[model samples]
Target: MGTVRPNVLIILVDDMGYSDIGCYGGEIGTPNLDSLAAGGVRLTNFYNTARCSPSRASLLTGLHPHQTGVAELVNNDGPGGYPGSLSLRCATLAESFRAAGYHTHLTGKWHLSNEREQPADTWPTRRGFDRFWGTISGAGSYFQPTTLHDGETPVPLSDLGPDFYYTDEIGTRAAAAIREATTPFFGYVAFTAPHWPLHAKDSDLAETRGLFDEGWDVLRTRRRQRQLEAGICSDDATLDHRDPAVPAWEDEPEQKWQLERMEAYAAQVRAMDRAVGTILAALEETGQRENTIVVFLSDNGGCAEELRSDPEGADQFRRHHLIIPPTAPDGTPMKVGNSPGISPGTADTYTSYGQAWANLSNTPFRRYKRWVHEGGIATPLIVSWPAGGLTGDVIHAPHQLTDIAPTLLEATGVPALAERDGEPVPALPGASMLGLLRGGEPVEHDLFWEHIGNAAIRSGDWKLVREYEGPWELYDLSADRSESNDLSAQHPDRVQDLADRWQRWADAVGVIPYGDVLAARATMPTQPA
Candidate 1:
């Protein structure tokens, strides 16, 4: 065997946007992440699945979500393609790494399986993680989360103390795992920070208390300007007009409360960043910093979903049961939503930053999460492998979440398996990005995305995309990264060809018909509100 492989750390944040990190042109303080970017390569055109579970499935299995049986969120429905859980036909990166003699550890949000049944076979431990510490579902109150688990068993809420913040616990546990591992390790630090419920520590929230008081309109312009100056976007890139559904900043009622909402979101991100710093520091203390490949990216773009004032209604919308009448440490009732007089950033609150702030989070992009637009799928992909000799470079090659597993496998010199447990595994649809990181010729491939009825296809600099039941829109992404101009009518043949290609790929991947998935969801038994 060759020399021992380098350690691998994959940091995935929930519901973060393309421009939310300091290195990616946002004003958020992310010194550790920015330092990684400065010392490594940043991919300007990397993409995610535009939703949480789907992105996680694709990233882990090295296959499209539909191919891994997670075409939709984590609730098995519809056909085999929409099983809503990681399938046996594909192997996870952790599984592969463990077979190659590396210790595997996963901490934080593991939404790859259905949480309602709590099936042990589908949990992270059975899926090949040696150690697992996280919530099975997607989003929840950070303070007192539901379905928290360790390895194969559920962790009791009584075991957690007042200082048990989800993001901090994730970092702490992952760092501990790294320290204890005797062999090269593959650690996944999946943080559910800044997703929803808008919770944060008072000290962290205080850091951004009056930061967003100017509102999203000013912040959006400022982020776009910074993006241009930092070469994150081209000088000729045009910022897309704000979504019509979002009211102008000046026209919004409850201005102070809205500002408070954004400040709370910023604080959540800052807290996650601090946790990242802690893990990186741990790696350095262990003398593993130089050999470890540290990657940081968000699962998807910023979320625009609003938190309902009714706890039951919110729980139903979130597709999970939440602890009703959530309370802070002081035992005060949590008030949820954008209603005036109720502030966020406390355990006594459940709220989201809303669409206007999500628009600002995505900066110059066109739409929010759940759509197939740039705003929905674009993510900041920072890869830091100091021993690999990568330094302060920007790679504009378009890559998908499916590429992550293959890239890591290649970087660690692990061979991909053709089968597992006598069952043939699906081949990875993405190519390794090592060459691109090392300043080699760009890897070119057509990429396709489908969520619900929304879909997009990118071939070279041209992209063809559409909303649910909407007309196809085309853009030359090289010049219009914001997707402001529709060139579909100007290039009807290209549109037809790209759409045809996407349809073929979708069919091959066993993607359930968009309408079928919707019908199945509609027919499911509704939870009582």
Candidate 2:
């Protein structure tokens, strides 16, 4: 008889940065995640797809986002790559594990399907998970989210009590799934905390009340120092300059409101950490800790979108057709943006930390989410498996989000199938990290990323990247991981080589031309949900 497989628990958070958790250099309280890092392995150079839907798609299937039919967000825009849904040609990690007799359960965001009306075919339950609970959209009100689902059925916010919190609910559902499992389980806890609409509990808010008074400039410098001390980055890695667009923190007039916004953001992060502790405790209580593989990572870097009502650009920013007005549970008006009067952390308010703070959250990395920069793509990856012999160590090898599915399969002894449902699926593009986890030599492979028109390709230590409609930039990531230095002019031949490699990969994966997608998106009435 074969030995029983180890349980797999993947905890994914939305819109968090490379260094928000304690283990990754942030001051936020994340003892549970820190403990995981202390006992397991931390991948310093891990990467993601730089956006929500694409990152989720890559992580779920061991294929690039374009190959998985989600090149962009959940909007059927250009062609085969941007189908706005998980393609039939792919098999999700949950599906593969469930077929191997592992009980698969998913709790939290499910943004894979574009047709929410007919979610039965693409929802978690139909996609190999035995059970499912969470939102179907990418972002929404934490208090009263739209399109909340429980195994293909719509779960109204009214069904939940006044004290209900989305992050807590995800953790609770994940714990319940872990406890009820009769067989080795594959549990996915996707928390939407610290994303946007910055609504956190009063207690959580109180804990971080004075935390951000020092402002983003100081916070950024402090985090960079901490990151260096923690060995999260190389000793010689220089901190990227503060974004030229963001004003100096000292010159900011709305200090009080700005501080409060950061406090709310930190509160959201802390609350998410607390939820992780709850799930970890449940793992211990259920006696699944020793043989369970717990993997925790963020979907993307900190978001910088200002989803608020701006009076200066009333025609543009305040357009009801463009922006959906956020509302509280009782239908009370919830104002969003950098408005001074409207303090965040309440259900009656919706706001983001803004670009300055997001820059701080990313700490030493350039740009924010959506761009093909280190800040947009880098993520802290924590993998803990006591039975797998993974110990406290930092692996600096560059690994993409797509590598996660194959890693889990290998760890749990589940075989990757060449075909599923009688269709020949594309071969897994990601290599398993099992060898690295066992303290073996790091694996070498080319890494690729594209969202909208922004694109990048990493071959060995050299990275060639370009923004939408922008010129190509090259950097030796081994020395300049922050991408501060553009070495394109110095290495024209290398630039052409990497660019050629990216073009071939893009074409092979059926990635629609960026210009075509952008033109199509311009004609569309709706903005990303």
Tens-place lDDT digits, model 1, residues 1-529 = 2365889999999999999889888887888889889889998899998999899998888999988888768776644226676887789998898998889999998888864336656678888799988888778878888778887677876788988888888888888998998999999999998798789888888888888777788888888888888788888878886788988889988898888888899999998998998899889999899899998999889999887766686555444354333455567755766566668878777788888889989988979899989999999999998887664588888999988888899989987778888999988889888888877888889999999889999999999999989999999999899899999999999999999999999889988878887777676654211
Give the poorly placed runs of model 1, Cα more than 4 Å off.
78-81, 310-319, 322-333, 527-529
| lDDT per residue as tens, model 2, 38-77 | 9999999899989888888888888999888887788876
Candidate 1 yields a Cα-based lDDT of 0.85
Pull out the clashing pairs in model 1. Answer: 334-348
Error of 2 at 48 (Å): 0.4
Cα displacement (angstroms), candidate 2, residue 19, comes to 1.3
